[model samples]
Target: MSIQAKSERALCEITRSIRTRLQDVYGPASADSLFHAVERLIQRKRRTLSVSAGPRFSEKDALLITYGDTFLSPDRSPLSTLHTFLQEEAGSLFSFLHLLPFYPWTSDDGFAVTDFRQVNPSLGTWQDIQALGKEWKLVFDGVVNHVSSDSLYMKAYQHGDPDAEDFFIALPPETDTRSVLRTRTLPLLHEYQTTQGPKWLWTTFGPDQIDLNFKNPKVFLEIIDVLLFYVEQGCRMIRLDAIPYLWKELGTSCAHLPQTHQLIKLFRDILDWVSPDILLLAEINAPWPDNVAYLGDGGDEAQLIYNFTLSPLILHALVCEDASNLTQWASRLPPLPAGTTLLNITASHDGIGIRPTEGVLPEEARRCLTELAVRHQGAVSGKKNSYGTVCSYELNVSYFDALNDPAVQEPQEVQVRRFMLAQLITFAFRGMPGVYIQSLIGSRNNLAGVRKTGRARTINRRQFDLTEIQQELGTPGHLRQSVLSEYRRLLSLRRKEKAFHPDAPQAVLDLSPSVFALKRGGLPGGEEILALHNVTNRTVRVDLSRYLSGERYQDRLTGVSYARTDLCTMDLTPYQCAWLKKETLISA
Candidate 1:
């Protein structure tokens, strides 16, 4: 079926399933309550499916930038840099920008919600975000996955206020809940004590980030109100953080439970009925097949799901010096639901996590990938450790590690060639790519925060210095320049090529393990473009002569052209990418 038809069918299926599920959960007599919760979502999904077929980048509600604990002011604001940033990177391609949770919280990089209604004073005022929202696309987070232990609501729960306690999921005393539902961090929960003895808290991330119990209907109602409030403030998209772990069940991995799907569908339904324009993006980090579940066989559950598989796979291909990982990962990629899209990106606020595809990657390959990372960082642990002391001036260091690595050479240029190529593949893939704030400026982990606090991620989260970027503009061909320049090139290419648009169909082409290829844009009279990427360090001769007969090839990035029979053995340099287009086709 076509993308539109598929989307429509998916909407119908989701609406039907939601209605049935609600009835089952609340009984037929509770139809009003069910309708009250889901009617909007059903209506919104239908409306979203009926949009005009064109480049969605033109109509995107927002362009998300990573806004950590502090929103860097232009002189100080990394986001205000958008005024110039939009001209360079976005260039009217997107209207919305998602500022990942800049609110005060304890763990999970601010996923632990301490305050729902207010923006963290450390970042800026609600007024600052509102003003920024006015000029550009505005998207604030609805980190409803869990609340912080220090949250006001949690405090109320601890003080025995029944009404406030109702907002959270506080465990019963003397109960051990750790084994079934695991927490990301240990020490915080390792020694737990409440009014009840040795009671376990539901921590999908850390003890500080206590997972809220969605089972409690009250939790649903309150969060809904919170979502509507943000929507009312002109926010276009609300990113549901750590969505899969929202609902927990026993004897199963608490993440991505059936109820989690139901909860998202319900949220979508409500939004549809109330505000059809608002988009709900799910941060469900799972493997390809499993991640598709969040799309609800169409566009019902979430309008956008994070393409975690693509980013990691691209990184894997780059780091491992083999495009096989990219091809293998792409082969397993599931289609997106109609009307909905995937939030694709290589780097974000958080460290890379590669556990989702364990089922598909060979044990040795996984071990090798792990070893490569450790070897780069000079870390001994095999645990995908992000905290390493590898001080190679050639390697890119996260902000946290940059400070800790005393060996960092001054004028350290972040080794960004492979990383940029990795991100290029990510943006060109079948999804809406999300470029993190740090990636734009090639910001490395801040070692200053690490030296001061001894925490790497937090240090990496330090506000950036745009002035320094402009002043020390010392090196012309440095990694920072390469990153900024390549991003512009790739994003520019994506805009010119219709295949990179949200509506375009993506097909993985047959190629060697060292080469990754995909075809996009078959618009009539508009030339079809084929993308080939070489992930190997050594040049690989690709026999694409078989597929190029009677065709002309043009490079999308540099407008370089070649005849179909010009060559049989195309030599690709290490970490190089090429876009081949027909000379007969119109160039954007």
Candidate 2:
């Protein structure tokens, strides 16, 4: 067949798929109109702009997750300050920058977006974001589930503007929302004095964040346009924040509804047609099954889903001093669908999520984890379950503090080693590792910030001044310097090894309860690296003879060579991590 004919056939198929997905929620007539509108948008984009396909996955494709204001300067905008830091200090340590919502926001530290199309003036302008994009691939947040109550759409609704009347979900005050899933303890509906009358609007997150009504096709189209604008602003990936709660149904739990998945597929289809290189990342913090559902058969939904369970599981393993649960969960992780991978992250702006640990970590263990966080000067946040009972939702603490107790007067070196071990485990996983900016410097719980802001999540969201952080990182014996130096060395070494590629084969090794091991590569006589991490506070000996095919292997971190005869018994010091590659492979 001719190339033109083949292209036409492919486009028709995708258009039909999009139409069917829209029909499932908006019915045939509405679906027809929405599909055509989307097609026009895609065509117009194709005709007016040219976006190159982004670089594919490699061993070096790690992402640095940070807010635009993570590194603030007295003279410059936050985004510009961050750009300078990335170029000078970070260098090429990261391939992508996951810039957490940089748009104007009313609350939730940028999650409650007041404006979708413009950058927060406190941060830099679009030019600054594009400049960062030139240095590193960029990830932008699509906070589409809700908008700030102060947003123009909400203001219009308050004024009873006909165009904005159906923008949000407004129901009767007596409406039953018992079945609606809640991520916050705040009331599901907040009464608003609109021009028409007093109406109760659905506020899934909080009253300051009003939920959008997807039942209205106009809202969906508007969001699609917003996301496309992000692509034009040079974002290679768009993170759909709080996406699982996008579509609501009256008679069922308004989370992960079929319509929600369909809408994601529609977004995927449009992006695939217009800018094929752009990726969709779903930020779902639910249980394993529900979290993985966002991947939608691997190719049609989100290209990336946060590895939400990994953070809590790692904490549980380290605190409990047992790797059994972590190993078991890793062993059973199903093969990812094509074109999809998890974004392996141990820490982020928010606290470590407890919801993702459901079914994997027992209730007793979770409770134990929460209690441990408190002991370490952390806090626990709760959510209301369907039973109207409040349950522990997340542990709000810095990743470093979660693992190392602040009251313990241990040697700083010991704390740094133990913390890096947790980070090493994340790197050894079979996905792209996302490093939070705070984790890079081994930051502790900011209890002062939490107390000041009256938000538990503020414990980990401390914004650092550029001069102060630079001074700390420059000090020879400082904790921040030590952690970042080691982290940089490990990251540099990881990029050089082909075995650490995102698509490299991984096999979990069940050697010892105190050890977490992964065999990467070595499929069909390829290069292999045996990654071993000791998650305890004491030395643990592991036998590696059965796993090694070479007579000698060298530790990539320390460059220590071990003969096969010596592999039967090897001692990993407390909190030590080793990436062992065959001596022959290293020599070749």
Candidate 3:
């Protein structure tokens, strides 16, 4: 088929898929209007690369996940300052910079977006984002699940405007919403005193944030336009925040709804048709089952789903000094498709969620991890059930602090080692690894931030002064400097091997309870990379004969080679992690 003909056919298929979804959520008339809006927007959006498919991400494609305001001063624009810092601190280390929610927000640390089209004034202008994009691959946040109650769209709903009447979810006082999943303990029905007097609006996340009604086709088109605007502005990947809750139905869990999955698939189809390079990464932080649902039959939905189970589970493994559960869970993960991979991250803007640890950690083990964080001066946020029982949801603390419990009073060097191990294992996981600002610089919990904001999540979202960070990172033997050096070394070693590609084959090796090992390779012409970690204080012996067929291997982290003696068993010191490359692959 001719190129133009193929393009037309793709457009028709996309339109058809979107129209069907629109009709399912709304009715025929709204579906037609929504399709027209999308068609016009797609036709007008030019400049996007018309590739057949996006190239698979590499181990070199490590992402630095941080807010645009992460590094700044009172005088300097945060985004511009961030660009400067990356050039010095993390430039070549991570290929992509994922700025979490740069839009103007009313609450939830920018997750409750007040305006999708405008850049937050404090975060600098679109020009700043473009500047960062020029220097590194940019990943923008798509906070489409809900909008801030202070937004203009909510104002229109208050005024009962025709086009915006159904933009938000609102039900009568007598309505039953008990089955809806609540991320917080706050009342689900937020009492809003608007121009329409008193309205009980659905607030899935919080009172300041209002759930958007995808039942309104106009809302879908509005969000679609915002996503396209991001792509036009040079975003290679757009992360959909809290996406599983996009569609709400009464007397149901209001999560992972069929309509929500349909909307995601619709988005992937339309966006890939427009620009195959722009990846749709779904931020569904549920357990493996619900989280895996976003992958959509292994192909059509999100190109990447955040491996939410990794961070907390890895922490649990290290805390308990047992990789048995982690190894068992990881072994069960099925192979990913040719181009898609999970987004493996150790930490982010929010706290370490326990929901993802449900299947991996036992009930008692789960409680212990949360208590361990609290024992180390961390806080726990809970969600209330119908019977008024509060269950722990997320542990609010820095990843470094979470791993190094003050109750045991681990030494500074030991704390740094444990923290770095957690971050390094993410690289060995079967996905694209990401580094968060707090975890990257080894920042401690900021109780001042939590007290000032009155939100537990702020404990780990502390903004650093670029000057102070530079000074501390340069200091020899300091915790920050130690963590930074080790993290950079991990990234440098990871990038040199093709076997570390996001889609490369991964086998979870059951070496011992005190250790976790991952093997990457086995593909034709692929280099075998072996990762070993000792999560305990005492030395543990691991036999290399079970993992490798070679007689000798080289450690990439340290330039050293050892000959296999007595079937090649090696002992690792406390909290030691080694990146081993096959002699054949390294010398070749």
Candidate 4:
């Protein structure tokens, strides 16, 4: 077939798939109008991209971008924030910008997507998102992992509407439903029920977020249409949130199941067949084995998987006061399939609880790690002294409480130092590190405000205040300056350092209980960089004669050069980090 013929065929198939999918969700007439809206959005995107075209986009050069309800500033300008962020921090490192679920919703930080076709007015309009997509690559949340029980479809389902009822997963009669559904994961929601009978709805997180049934082919097709619609709306990437829970099996956690991978692979294949430019990121909150599997053997599944393990490793090293845990984790990493990447981050809006690193630390140390996270989170809400005991380890806040906390304040310089250090470690470590916008400006958690609002997670979703951040930035010796400086330093090094890019795989060099060391090679230019971190509260020395045979190693961070074994007995200050680069083939 001619190239033009192939393009036309691909477009036609996508149109047909989208129409059928939308008809299943909405009626056929609504789907038609939605399809037209999508086409207009895509045209706008294409026109936007036409103005400043760079290198022609290839399939391999895909980026997974994401935004959330609280991802925006109070002014609700994710585009301007993203534009500045890409220009200042990311530059050309990323080709995609995923504006997370920005649509209007009743609860769960907009995860309960109310409208599939329109942008939430609280966030910018759909036009703003389309315009942003035009200038940069774009990704959006499928968020079909679960829908709000109060969602339009769910309401229809409750009202005995035949069409909308099939769109959601409903349990059997009350007695049969008890065998299949779970009531509450939270402390407060001990019981829940649906109108279909006395049957309890299966809620993994809460009563609000209802898990979708992927066993039903209708559900699969409906979500696939959502995917196609976003692609038509100019999204080049789609984030599959809470993917592990999509398919449930008896007597198991029902996460990251075999079918899950198959389904994601199917989505990947479809996108490849349709646009080739669009990518899927699987939000599978699983361990390394399960997480890595999402990448598939041929790199044909998820293009990006969250490096959920690595983020906690950064925090653990800081709190344990040793870098060894991080280095140990890095040592065990297997090589990833080509054309795949890990999304690494330190802190996010999501509550970082004890589950992520439960068994990773010694029992005695776990308490300290827990305390540090709580305190750090507490600091975000401007409630450093409210907790009474610093190491109390009280699982006090709820998910919603953290999101809505109005007092979510920025941390002080000392606190920001520890936070920024963790983030720097994230940046220097292997995989693509993500800097949460709140953390970048040293934004804090909201304590009193959340308490006032009676929402525990409110602090987690507080809007970014640029004016407050600007005022804080004006303070010469503030935490904001310190964070900004360290971030600039780390990001600048990442930009210049070839070892920290997409292709570099990490290897562990030292795994002592107190210190951690990592090696990064396979740079685009084939150069090698060695990073060593000291996690102990006191100085500790490690012999580098075994790792380095050269007479000297150059410190990438501090411009100092040392003879090979000089580092063998050299002591590192508490929480100090070193990045050294050398040619692999040095002649004697």
The residue-by-residue lDDT of candidate 2 on 1-588, one tens digit each, is 997898779778878888888899899878888888887877766664454456558788899999999888989999999988887778899998999999999999999888899989989899999899999989999999999999989989999898896999988888888887788988899988888988899999999999999998889889988888888888888999999899988767789998899999989988877777888999998999999889897568999999999999999998888999999999999988877888999999888999998899888999999999899999899988774788988898999999889999999998898889889998989889999999998798988898899999989888899999999999999999999998899999888888888778899999999999999985465679999999999999998878978898899999898988887788999988999988888855
Which candidate comes out best when scored by TM-score?
2
Which tens-of-lDDT digit does each residue in 243-296 have in candidate 4? 776777654545666777767776765566446666677876545777789998
Would you list the clashing residue pairs of candidate 2? Answer: none
lDDT of 3 by residue, 358-439 (tens): 7678999999988888898999888765435678888898888788865576678888878878877888888889888888
Q: Relative to the true structure, how large is the alpha-carbon lDDT of every model?
A: 0.62, 0.89, 0.84, 0.61
lDDT score at residue 26, model 2, on the 0-100 scale: 92
User: Whose lDDT is higher: candidate 2's or candidate 4's?
Assistant: 2
Identify the candidate with maximal lDDT.
Answer: 2
User: lDDT by residue for model 1 over 429-508, one digit each (tens)?
Assistant: 77677877676666655656657765434533556454455443335776566666666666765766665667567788
Stretches off by above 4 angstroms in model 2 are 1-9, 523-526
In model 4, state the lDDT of residue 282. Answer: 80
Deviation (Å) of 84 in candidate 1? 7.1
The order by descending TM-score is 2, 3, 1, 4
Between candidates 1 and 2, the one scoring higher on TM-score is: 2
